[model samples]
Target: MLSEASNFWGLFKSGSKEREFRKAVEQIIGEKPSNPLLYQLAFRHTSASKETNIGGFRESNERLEYLGDSVLGMIVAEYLFKKYPFKDEGFLTEIRSRIVNRESLNQVARKIGLEKLIQFDGQRIAHNRTSMYGDAMEALIGAIYLDKGFRFTRSFILKKLIANYFDLDAVIQTNTNYKSILLSWAQQEGKKIVFEIVQENGKHHHKEFVAQVKVNGEAISTGGGWNKKKAEQEAARRACESLEIKSTQ
Candidate 1:
């Protein structure tokens, strides 16, 4: 365990870490952090624990990340629900998926300088994989919740993350299974549609499937997913959107 004195000195060393952390938090929340420790843990990567040897004594931000992930989901869900009062569950779920997915979270992390503060294993950092950085970002959010609390985290998410980064209105409208809609429309128009699974491979637990959607003997779209059904749905949606746009133009 780091003694109280050591913790103080560690924070005081160059002050830059704390400063950067504060800046990031401010950028996210639109205000300075009330709790310094929360900001510190928000940037505390698991890799740093290995270096300090007090790894066991000082907890990683994983727990906080888990909490933050849940909190983030709820917040986004609620926002969507209120913003688009008329949207159905399926539409709401798709919009949430687009907003909270790996790519979206990474974009938020990068925008807030979370990437620079991450402390990860050198090898993993050098490789620059998605899972590591994505997990680290979630862990940081979790830490923020623990250190500061939900109100502040929500403030940061809404004002900085959501308002500044994402086009919530546009996402809600467009982030949908267009293939499904297109297929439905085609069938209504007395057209036949089919989705064929072309390939399936990967470990049993993590297998992926590729599917193509066809209409009237013409291939309309292709997509991949963890399962055949999902892949087909995605392809169908894409095909529908493309065909619709072409017809209108």
Candidate 2:
């Protein structure tokens, strides 16, 4: 009787597993997987191994994450360079930071609903950290690269990710502050401009301060920086740019 029950359980479990596997494949490839086993392995988190019974033959996405990191960096760097030929190194670095930061990558992952399909144990899944999700997203990209080749992956990134979310012009323009220059100009023109440090946080050596610049009793702009002078300058620079103050006195 026990042997018969075991056989029945195995048959039912196999069918259920196949259905779940197919759903995961559909989610990743946007269609049924030709190689269903590969899709199954891709979705298998290290923690879920014991239940899946795949043994040591299956590999986790860690290696894929490493490859994807390099690929993403290269792709984003190339894209930025070609898009902004006139941009200097410092300017380019800042824009890249905004684009490839942890928050940015997580946003991209959430946009694609990649988080829902991630397989993990209850404890690991419960944490729901941004870094974990972002890592998985990168690993998925690497898997896609391996499966579909570079051209397809690149086109997908351009169409589905870059074109849909990122705005090149907006990123470049907001890279730096011009308000400080305007404040200086106003002062030189015998006009009054005041920069008040409203708040400060962090240690003395690594302090961050927020400053608001006001011109003739009207608040022009606010900026944050590592120091009072820099913060004030950023605020003033922004004010100048916004107001279109031309004279650089």
Candidate 3:
């Protein structure tokens, strides 16, 4: 935790470029970062990474993104669990996915001004920016978690990101319905689609179902869930991604 006076003096002493980045981050997150280096690492894209240590190890936001992904999922899961106490596991899972999906993260990241701070090879990723902003968003979460710990990070997510950007009613009402979309696409393309329960684990209420979607007798994708329908829907969603089929929603 940097004192306000120290933070201002530190910024005053830093290089012009460093001061700019620090100020930008402070504006985005609504606080002075205790450790600015973490934020710097968080915005570093792999495209602009350089080998920094032993063997082919490079410094980039990937590791932070991985950590942030888990943290984000847990936070969202807990939020959904409490917000919709009457909802089942499937409902919670689906809603969580909708909230943290790549597209949603990307949109949120851009909306929060991360796109300007992310250090990426623009020419290299000019056509592949879909996941870039989203990845940096996760990394930023990880950095926040490290710097401020879970409680503060959670508050920031719920208050700053979720409260400002997400509409719970809208998210709940919107249906991508990947299964229906995949089926319709299969019918139009004359491809036979079959969803089969490949595996079931555990017993009773805790059991998990794995569904595999096969097209023309070959497996296209597989998904797992607490129920058969949800598992098949996940498989359909993956298959749609593989087939480049856009959702109607």
Residues 146-170 of candidate 2 have per-residue lDDT tens digits of: 7777776677667777888788777
Weakest 10 consecutive residues of candidate 3 by summed lDDT: 1-10
Pairs with backbone N, CA or C atoms under 3 Å apart (clashes), candidate 2: 178-237, 178-238, 179-236, 179-237, 179-238, 179-239, 180-236, 180-237
Model 2: residues >4 Å from true position, as ranges? 1-39, 45-58, 173-249
Which candidate has the top score in TM-score?
3
Better of 1 and 2 by TM-score: 1
Model 1 lDDT per residue over 1-249, tens place: 432322443553477856865776676556677776655655555444433356457655566678778888888898889988998998788788888876678777777666665544443233143344556567666766766688877776777778889987676556355555765677678888877998886654346788998888888889877657667767876786677632221
lDDT of 3 at 21: 78
Q: Spell out the clash pairs found in candidate 1.
A: 64-142, 178-237, 179-236, 179-237
* Residue 36, candidate 3: alpha-carbon lDDT: 95
Q: Give lDDT per model, in order.
A: 0.66, 0.64, 0.83
lDDT of 3 by residue, 1-249 (tens): 422322343453458968777888899888899999899889877766769768889898999999999999999999999999999998899889889977789899999988767776544444142377889999999999999899988998999999999999999888677987898898889999999999998654246789999999999999987668778888999999998998555
Report RMSD (Å) for each prediction in the order shown. Answer: 7.7, 11.5, 11.3
Candidate with maximal lDDT: 3
